[model samples]
Target chain A: MRPALLFPLLGLTVALLFAGSLLTGPAAIGLGDSLAALFRGEGEAVVLVMREIRLPRALLGLMVGAALGASGAAMQGLLRNPLAEPGLIGTSAAAALGAVIALQTGLAAAFPPALPLLALAGAVVSVLAILGLAGPRGGSLTLILAGIAISALAAAFTALVLSLSPNPFAASEIVFWMMGSLADRSMLHVWIALPAMLAGALLLAGTGRGLDALTLGEDAAATLGLPVARLRLAVVLGVAALVGAATAVAGAVGFVGLVVPHLLRRAVGARPARLVPAAALGGAAVVLAADIAVRLIAPDRDLKLGVLTALVGAPFFLHLILKSRGERP
Target chain B: MTLLALDRLSVTRAGRPVLEGATLTIGAGEVVGLIGPNGAGKTTLLRAALGLIPAKGHASLAALPPARRARAAAFLPQQRDIAWPMPVAAVVALGRVAHAGSAGPADRAAVERALAAMGLADLAARPATELSGGEQARVLIARVLAQEAPLILADEPVAGLDPAQQIATMQVFAAHAAAGGAVLASLHDLGLAARHCTRLVMMQAGRIVADGPPAAVLTGAHLARVFGIRAQLSEGPDGPLFQTLGLL
Candidate 1:
């Protein structure tokens, strides 16, 4: 698809899925009632449900999906690897560990913003570590290896936090958190995640030209007058912020980054800079659609968002690996 | 005008000198070919001169700011890398990155001119990754051309090209020089270097052994000592023809 057509189509799809997410809930609220209560605040109970519950969920979906998608595109562009995403590179996992630490240590309970803030801190640390381990001129393989190591270490620490917890209820909540969901979230979560996500988007947005030049590899990009070091720094900080915020608010929503960019790469003609915005919209659509599916699949039981995304994304990941293998000698 | 000036440039890798005390200057309307045996510091010299790597000596281009450096000199690496399947035109348009803003008329014209020069006008809309290896080499060369910098530093620019394309590429570099620019290309093909370049700088083991006009630099002694090759050098109708007969 031409960019002119692709952007609008993706925007429309996101809008429809946003509506679907808002409308599809276990409360049995009608579409008209939901919209009226959401915007006009008409019905008392319905207004509470719409404004307090559904609206924030939908908004978080858009924000988280956009962050993941944009970060994924930026990562792929910087590293010149399609498989490079926040989750695979340990950004999300490190963020999750941060959130876990905040929860278990009662920091989140003491302060409302500590959850996402700590997660952002965690992301920054992990990203810095990845950069250090990967080195300045690290290859794709070195990056991935470093990421795998960081991810394992972070995941182990998170599990250690869970095991060392005295409160079994908090432990159970941590387990549920690990599964990831949008249930019972309020406007507070949205406000908490918003600033970091916006900051990340702003940073990643400036990297398009650099990423485009990087398609010719780092040495050529440097010769083309791009500040390659600055580009890497921005990408690192941006990915950390975005992934940390999203993981803090919505546990670990896996594969939205990987799957969305892969789906939209062709639509955007495989240009990394062009892929960022397109993938952002496409990611929002995919997540909203999946969020709606989770609600529809088990209206009463609360099906986790990660479960749905992984169900769809894991097979897609396999397909990508097989396809790439076929393409190689 | 001197487009590039390097004074006693030196590069060390892992505490060992890879390029040592290489001083050369390239002026406008000059196509200077850098020829040497493998690992003889030709690549290191070009990189050090362009300020792509940290080096010990002064390089005029290296002294400028990155943005100004890009406007002054464009470099083409030995490796041909097109990470995505972007259209050939899009890949070429990336050359205008340093110019800022979207692709304006001037940028578009430069891209079109580069495409036509490299005979890739028809492949403009095609995915660059889908082309044959030689065609991809041409596209990369076109991208370098699209940069429109006054000085071009190309490492093995014609390595993968066919004979005719190689000649055409050398002609393109020559044309760039004729248009008041300069090109310093590292090449292994001594014949092409001898015939097309206005001057040749030959290196042996981290040092320049000779630097002058092609006829003066491509001496039998330089060939034997630097490249370890016994070559026959004769004057063809077009220019000097250098043919390697056996190892020294």
Candidate 2:
């Protein structure tokens, strides 16, 4: 497909999925009624459900999904590896660790913004650590190895925190938070994460040209006048803010970032620059669809969004591995 | 006028010197072949000249601002890595990255011209990674050509090409020089260097052991002393013919 047509198609799909997300739930809210309540604030119960509950859910899904998708694409482009994702750099794991701390200490229940704030802090620390570990001229191998070590450490610490929690209630809360969800979010959640996500998305967007140059390799890109150090900084900070804000709002959602970019890369002609926006749109659509499916598949049970994404994404990941193996000589 | 000048440039890697006090100047309309045995700092010199690595002393091109430096000189590294399977055209278009937001008709024309120059016009839509090694090398060379810089630094740009393709690639560099650009290419093929390069600079043990015209620099004594090889030099119809007799 031509690059011009690809964006609009992805945008329309995301819009349709957004609408689908808003219309789904236990209540029998008709599409027309939901649209009316969403736009015109008609009918008391309809307005309450649409405004206070479903609207926030759909908005979070779009924002968080877009963040993960764009971050994933940027990560892959920077590392020049197709399998790279937001989680690879330890941002998601570190953010999850922060949120787990908030839950275990009962700070999240006491204060609403404390969860995301701490999570963002964790992401910032992880970015700093990775940058410090991988020096200015460190190659991709060094960066990847550093990220793996940081991720493993964060995961271990998070597990330790959960195991040592004072009560089973706190442990369960931490477990549920780690499972990832979009339930009971408010406009406050949207307002808190929106600015960081926007800033991160802007940073990632500016790296398109640099990322394109990087296809030639780092030395060639540097010689092409790309300040490779600055590019790395921007990508790291941008991904940190995005995945941090995302995990803060919706727990530790996985696979959307890793899966969406891989799926849309071919459609974008495998150009890293074009894949950024396409993956963002595709991510939003996938997350919204998954969120909707979660509601319909098991309405009585509180089905987690991360669980469903893993259920779908893990198989796709395996298939990609097998396909790659088959193509190898 | 000198398009590139290196004044006593020196580089040390892992606490060991790789290039020591290497002074050279490449004038416009000259193709200077950097010839040296393995670990003789040919690659290091090109990299340091392009500011890809840290070194002592000064490289004139490295002193310019990054974008201005990029516009002034295009570099092709020793490694030809195409990480993604992007189309040939898209990969070649990456040369215009430094000129971002300024691309217009001229940039498109340059890309088309480069593709044609490297005989890649027919494979413009093919995935770059799917191409053969020689084809991929040509594509990368096309990418450098599209940069349209006044100076070009290429490290082993024609290493994997067939004999015909190798000559054609050298001719492309010669043509670039004839069009008022300066090219400093590191080469291992003594014969190609003797035939195509306007001048030759031979290095040994992190220093330039000889620098002059090919006929003056690639003599039997220098070959035996620097490369530890006995070479027979004779004049062929086209240019100087170099034949390695045996290891000294």
Candidate 3:
């Protein structure tokens, strides 16, 4: 488990899953034919399935998963809490609220980008609120408390929006959207989220050194010349842009951010810097695998990506809590 | 040469002043012990001096740019926190974060030297969080040592250590000073301070009550007035030893 080797291994896993995602749909296109259609765009039906249908879905899976994973790693590093994630600070919940608003008002159906745009707006508002409430130099406890308050408010508002939906179909749409999916995403969806995800990933990647210094505690890290305030800003904005754009497109995908980093931390020797790229790749792989599982496990029923991840991740979360408790004096 | 200078530095926390117009200077090749009671602002002064918090006056090192300030002084906080179970070597290597892109053989050598200095060579591969409190303290000390800054500010760096480890840790600070660096350490062990520190600054009620050589500052009158304690002072083979007799 040398750090150098871990990256390539994770990369291979992601590639395999990406390919698996492309080949695992209901059409049963051969791997060689799908690969050829993906590259050459020669056959009409194969090209239609590979290029128009599966490519965007698989690509979105990679981007969203990478975003969640990297954001999760950065959040954990900043808070110095293993359980910390993008959702803990209300980014995902706020995004879900935004998407729910779009669905409730029927704007998402009318305008293609409204859902993602409104979701990103929600994420931005929640992040701004957290920063405003916590202030620049507020300690971790204050930040977490603010996040909790924002999350509760967002969750309440979302439920209210759902309860007051004009029609039962809108309510169902809202509920299904909250469950999260990579279904029916097109190239337009990829284009919408790619820039924000890239920006967020770059910002999170830049925080490696600051995050490493934070292991010594905030005071010590500050004394070590880490621009702690700036670091917090970068992480918050990064997670907001990432999780926001993700929720905009895929609805409220959960657990990939929280679980991926936890799984890869030991492989990177618990170094936050090393975990960033590793978690990014691992996240993409997890999402792709989960998306594939959703397709295969319930082919006829649209099994949501978030549901599968939560099903797997919730038990893992419990196991971690139990292990942590056992380790405590 | 003066490595660190604080002029009229004051700090107020929660509407109450914790350090009031405290001024001190540390010269290269000096191990200065900051001795005070629980709420006497020793930790506050160190924190302000390192620019970890806002202060009324000025700290010369704190005025520098963050990168330069980090290169100039290394700080060890009162709390020993290693957030993750990172390997000991990796934790020690974190000291070079400020010196990023320049971590050549010299940085590795310095880290290795620090590990050896703190008797952590054998445990370099072990998880830092899994170690005992004393071992963790030493590991953090090793991190500071690897920082190789000209000035060091340590808040209770030797607390929870065994007697031998405490002496050994103090000797490391003394050695750092002897090598032309400067150290200002907040310590509760009066005996160790008297033996190892080149000078002592004693604070009471958010102010420096005494500042001089240990023998001049830790006298019976100052002890009674500042600490509200009676002490019996005697000269041991290693240095001046004082025993607390009773509360005054």
Candidate 4:
């Protein structure tokens, strides 16, 4: 892509983000107050909201979005399938199940932590299971089938928990969370997932060349001296970590991971490596916009994050499916 | 040194036998054409040479076991789909995956040379999946060339190419042999085979019925027997010639 066009377009989206996060809410804190509180030099109620609560939430949204975006791109690339999205593979569903189980068992409360870790572990396990079921030499269909299996298994398990729940709110809350949300998230959630997601993202970044080779097909990739099986392993683990961490904290936020990467393929000149960064920025933008929309549109109802994304994303997803179908095989 | 050697090889897929007790050998710097009737196990043979399919056989490439044959021989399957809009250069680079630990300067040069040889230098930036059938065939061949292995096993390399592309692809295979590399390509074009191949192995059912220079193997009766097409064989200045008369 022309650097001039690409940079500014991406820069502008990121730039607009500052306003979406800051300008919303009844307080209506502007750039000045947000920046001041961001510096930790300001001492006021406005500063407190901007600095402590809102800032972390916004940063966390950025991290979650970036994680989803990068992991999604990597999954599509490694699988060599455009329809490949991290959420579709049941990583998020499995992670959400882990978080629910942790909470229900009270182990997470007793440990005062390990909830995100457990969630991440659950996601990785599901991914591995999918990989195993798909077989080492399996291509797009194999991965897709494996992913559906994981999603079904995880969703079923989560449903089982909800059915067994004594609290009426637990099932609905699980539903809302599975639908995805970023409301009432704390700095603690940020600290839990950010570092690990970031690490996985960087690992994915290093795999751009490998992913490029994968476009030719696995047999071709293997002939290039690349360990095709090993690449599959790395990509699966990366998806689990990033999506698991994000879902564990933010609930199973749908479509951002899927749509962000699809759009970024065009944004970053259609290169897989280029799509990674673009997807990251685009993911952050999409999530933050959805988050703000959720908050502003139904302040009383406190619309779930997942619900907002699905409402906005469902039509777009359908359009994409139709568009892809019309094109060549 | 021998580039590929298969002994007492048998291939079965889904409880059906494709090849049973098939034996073959290709020496370094030789271009061998595998000519077979439909269901004669041409693809199965090529695949077995690369160990892509499980077979009960003793296959060796450069004294290495069958499992590591990819490091010694490059394989190009008959049906190829890139699945993504990949750059041609990236597609070709997949040929070097077996050399992961030590990708030296030679690997890069081979990639460039392969692209240039296949006349894909200009199309390197384009998406591979978008290319036409002939272009994809060339690009895939370039990928195998980049593998830089001594033995090249290609299935139906000219299946979909125009006459010109068929000639050009044959020239590339000829060039590989000239450069002291081994090549084994399954071909239906008997004329091209007679012209370029150092040896020809003709198959009927799942076994080799004839193996020798093109002159001896592609006899008129042999074509009629295997292909169910009557033809006349005559010697030319260049090589053995076949003129198909009609369906048997």
Q: Judged by DockQ relative to the true structure, which candidate is superior, 1 or 4? A: 1
CA deviation > 4 Å runs, candidate 4:
A3-12, A15-26, A44-48, A102-118, A135-140, A202-206, A267-269, A295-301, A321-329, B14-17, B61-72, B93-112, B121-125, B146-148, B246-248
Q: Tens digit of lDDT per residue, candidate 2, span A94-154?
A: 8898888888888899997889888888888888888899876667788889889999999
User: Candidate 1, which segments miss by more than 4 Å at Cα?
Assistant: A106-114, A128-146, A324-329
Task: Give candidate 2 misplaced runs (Cα > 4 Å).
Answer: A135-138, B100-102
Question: Which parts of model 3 have CA positions greater than 4 angstroms off?
Answer: A324-329
lDDT of 1 by residue, B149-214 (tens): 999999999998999999999999999999999999999999999999999999989999899999
- Report the Cα interface RMSD of each model, rounded to 1 decimal: 0.7, 0.8, 0.7, 3.8
lDDT: the better of candidates 1 and 2? 2
Computed on C-alphas against the true complex, the DockQ of each candidate is 0.88, 0.87, 0.89, 0.36
Supply the global lDDT for candidate 3. 0.91
User: What's the TM-score of each model vs. the native?
Assistant: 0.96, 0.98, 0.98, 0.86
| Clashing residue pairs found in predicted model 3 | none
Per-candidate Cα lDDT values, in order, are 0.89, 0.90, 0.91, 0.78
- What is the per-residue lDDT of model 3 for residues B167-229, given as tens digits with 9 covering 90 to 100? 999999989999999899999988888888999999998999899999999999999888898
Candidate 1 docking band: high
Distance (Å) between predicted and true CA of A50, model 1? 0.3
Give per-candidate clash totals. Answer: 0, 0, 0, 14
Give the range where candidate 1 chain A is weakest over 10 consecutive residues by summed lDDT: A135-144
